[model samples]
Target chain A: MIRVRDLTIRVGSFALEGVSFTVAAGRYAVLMGKTGSGKSTLLEAITGLRPIEAGSVELLGRDVTRLKPADRGVGYVPQDLALFPTMTVREHLAFAQAIRGWDRTPTEQRVAELADLLGIDHLLDRQPQGLSGGEAQRTALGRALSFRPRVLLLDEPLSALDEETREGMYDLLRTVHRETGVTVLHVTHSLTEAKKLGDCIFRLADGKIGEMA
Target chain B: MSSRRRGTTPSTGRSDVPFLVALGVMGGFYVLLIVGMLVADVLSTTPGHLWALLKNRDIRYSIKLSLISCTITAILSVWVAVPLGYLLSRYQFRGKALLDVLLDIPIVLPPLVIGLCLLILFSTPPGRGVQQFVQVTYAIPSVIIAQFAVAAAFAVRTMRVAFDQISPRQEQVALTLGCSRSQAFWRVVLPQARQGVLTAGTVAWARAMGEFGPVLVFSGTTRGYTEVLPTTVFLELSTYSLEGAVAVSVLMVIVALVVLLIVRVYGMGSAPVGGR
Candidate 1:
């Protein structure tokens, strides 16, 4: 479970003020917002990429307000996916395990499992430049899941996909959540996406977060 | 059709006659001037003279010294440029703009003026205190120091452009994937910046190899002591040895061409992260 209590973040002229939310363990929580609603900024603050102006963040019953992103045990997929273009898909999957000092046999097993689970096994040797949009998204997701993170944060990851591909991704996401039992906080502006994916829905408006019935 | 009609046909395109002529004449004159000198030198100087110049004890010593000093200057330049470039690219603090402007001082100033400034610094209280422990001015060390001051400025400029092209998002993702700050920099940032570092190093080495005024003024072009390629050319010209001067100049031209070729190949192969 992830809890953001009275979280305030300021980025230049825009601000997210006194926002609060919670997602129950193993739930797919979708955060919906309009354009420039500071949704991405809120996600970045949770990932420790952006500094919080006020309030605290707690993850899995531990206060992670002052923790670094790597220490928070969270996987983030930005809107652009932000894949390391220079690294091959295999290297990208191996990166997190290498950095976290995971054992070789186990890390290799995890990487192979994620590659198979995400259907990116065939594209592991290719760089991001050679990948199609769906393949890149799956690779990004596989990388995020390689370390077996406690929470997954996605920001409009399916926005670039076509309607058909988006549907496939939704199913894949649902399967990922159900099988791994990991919490997810996905940000998007599409009502259909929110309706399809969210077990608990939170709407952000005017720098405030309110839970939907 | 008539000759006049043929001339007016626009098949030649709307060429700016005067502008094209001017560009051709100006560029042609400069290229011809350099080529003319090299051609004239080759025609006048015999193989014996060129070979003798190369075999001269003083010339050999100057070549060795120049190579060693320039290599050291290039390495030192990159060593400073990498961290300084990263800081300038990533952070914003007080006086950052001023510091950026200050980095360009050596590049903008005349080379002789830079040497003059270094000479004056070494004579000052703080510099003199350091000099008491290690000799610099008018010594062999002065050659490397003088070359480094100017070459490092160029290297830093090159590295800044390199770092500027890379997105901070890449490093952020690395950090989120479990890399510490240093680990992210070493593993992610450094690999991406490798081409830039090579370009900077080559440019710095080329600049250091050809630096003349600063080494002459600060290091004092002592024969067989601090005399580098540029200073060797100066010494040859001073003694009216045109053949010897031309030989050394030709050597410098060859070295510069090699360095530039390496830079071009590396740069073209590994275009900066965000660049076209």
Candidate 2:
């Protein structure tokens, strides 16, 4: 479970004031808001990328507010998927393992497993440059799962995809959530996605969580 | 011959008429100069003396010294510049523009002024802070310092631009994957900027290797000590060793050509990946 209490942050010309929410374990919690509604900022604040002026974040009943982003055990999939361009897909898989100081063999196996699960096994040899929208998102998802993060944060993951691909990705994401049982905090402006996938909906306006459904 | 026709207009269908005309004028001059130089160098190469000049001790020392010091500068410059470049590119902090401008100062200064400044700063007791601390004055170390000053400036500028071209979104995704900031940087960001880094390093090293004025002032023009290729050429030309000087010139040209060819090959291989 993840609990965020009274989170506040001030960026240039934008501010989030006293935002708070709770996402139950294995539950899909979607934050719905229009552009510049602090939906992304809330995610960033929870991940420690943005400085919270006043707040406390609790993950699995542990106070993670003071912890660095690396120590949070939280997976963040930015809107763009941020795969390293210099590496082949295979090398990126290896790097995911290498970063955690995990064994090389197990890392390879896990990469294979994730690739298979995400339907990107064939693209393992390719670079991010050649990846299609769906493929890139899958690879990004695979990279996030390699470390077995306790919670996954998705920032408008479906927005960049075409209509067809976005629908496919939504289905894939639903299946992945069911199989993995990871806590998901998905941010989106689309009310339809919120109604379809969210077990609970939190409406954010002017950087505050107004109400929950 | 029955139905073929050709005109001054380009047939490839890119028709920015004014831009193409401007590009043609500049490009034409550049091509003409290069072709003229290549022809001249080829025509001037006499077999008998070219072989004999290679045997000279001073010539050999100049070539050897130039390669060694410039290489050292390149290595050091890249070592420091990579991290600095990445930081500057990725982070928003106080005084960023000032820091950038300071790093770029070496590139804007005249090479002769740089040498003069090095001479003053490393010369004696009062202004010898660097010499006292590191003891690189009037030696190969001074030459390295001079080369590093310029080379690092070039590298930082190149890498900064390269890193800017890459979106920060890539590393942010890695961070969400439980990777540390450094891990994300090494795995995602650095690899993405690899070609830019390579191109920058190549340009920096080439610039350093061909540097003459600053190196001469800082390292001195002593034979087998600080006498790099250009300095040796100057010494030879001054002392009326005209053939020897020409031979050194020919050697410099050859080395430069080889480096250019290597950069071209590497660049071509890497170019396609960054386009997308």
Candidate 3:
């Protein structure tokens, strides 16, 4: 479960004012917002990338408002996917495990499992440059899932894909959620994407979060 | 197949031809001037004379000292440049513009002025305190310090550009993937910066190797002591050994070309990886 209570963040002239939201455990929650609605900013605040001016971020029933990003145990896949260009697909998947001090055998097994789960095993040796949009998204998903964080923060992870590819990714994302039972907070402007994937939908507007009917 | 057309196009309608030709001639003349001098030196000096100059103990010592000191200066410059450049690139703070201008002073100021400033600093209380612990002025260490004063500015400039080119998004993603801030920097940012660092190092080394004014003023170009290649050229020229000076200049040119070649090769190999 993830809970953000009255989270307010200011970045230069833009501000997210007293925004709050909650996603039940294991639910695929979609956050709908227009451009410049502070969707990405809110996600960054949750991940501790952006400092909250007020209020708190709680993850899995723990107060992690002041925790460092690495200590927050939140997996984030930004809009760009932001893959490390120098690293191979395998390295990308293994990075979180290595950083979190996972044991080698289990880590390898987890990487293999994620590769299989994401259907990126064939692209394991390739770097980000060689990957297609769908493949890169899969690799990013695999990387986010590598550490098995309690919540996954997806910032328009499928926005760059074509219609066909986006459909595939939506299915893939839903399947992954059902299989792993990990909570997801997916941010997007696409109403269709929300209707198709969200167990719970929250609309973000005017720097506030309101649960949809 | 198109040779006839290619040969006639410039003469037919290209009004820029005259301007291009004039520009080319001026560029060629400037290059030829330097090349012609080097050629003239080569023609006048015999193999025996070059060998003797190379074998001179003072020249040999100066060459060795230049290589060692320049290499150290290059390493130290990059060592300082990386973190400093990252800070300058990624952060906004009060007096940042002033700090940037301060970093650039060594690059723009007359080298002798920098040497004078160092001399003045070392004579002060804090400078004397440092000198009491370790010799600086008129010492070999001063050669490196002087070189570093200018070379580090160049390195910092190169590294700032490098860090500026990398998106902070990559580092953020690394942090989200369980890397601490330092971990993200080392794993993500540093690897991307490797080519820039190498380029900065070589450029700094080349600059340090060729630096004369600061070394002369601050370190003192004493033979078998603090003399380096550029200082050796000065000493040789003062003694009316034009051949010896040209030889040293040629050696410096060769070293610079080799470093540049390495940088080119490195840049080529890493270009694809850094495309992001």
lDDT of each: 0.89, 0.81, 0.90
Write model 1 residue lDDT over B49-90, tens digit each, in one string.
767877899988888898899889999999999998999999
How close is chain B to the truth by TM-score, in each candidate?
A: 0.83, 0.84, 0.85
Candidate 2's C-alpha runs over 4 A off are A90-95, B1-18, B93-95, B125-137, B240-244, B267-272
DockQ, in order, for the candidates? 0.43, 0.47, 0.56
lDDT: which candidate is best? 3
Is 2 or 3 the stronger prediction by TM-score?
3
State iRMS for model 1: 2.7
- Residue-wise C-alpha lDDT for candidate 3, range B109-147, written one tens digit per residue: 999999999999899999999999999999999999999
lDDT by residue (A5-68, candidate 3, tens digit) is 9888999999998888889898999999999999999999999999888999999999999998
lDDT of 2 at B141: 83
Where does candidate 1 stray beyond 4 Å? Answer: B1-49, B263-276
Regions more than 4 Å wrong, model 3: B1-49, B266-274
Clashes of each: 0, 5, 0
Q: Which consecutive 10 residues in model 2 chain B have the weakest lDDT in total? A: B1-10
For model 1, how does the per-residue alpha-carbon lDDT over A1-213 read when each residue is reduced to its tens digit? 999999888888888888989998889999999979988999999999999989999999999999998899899999988888678899899999999788889888888899889988888888888888898999889888888888999999999999899999999999899989999999999999999999989999999899884
- TM-score of every candidate relative to the true structure: 0.89, 0.88, 0.90
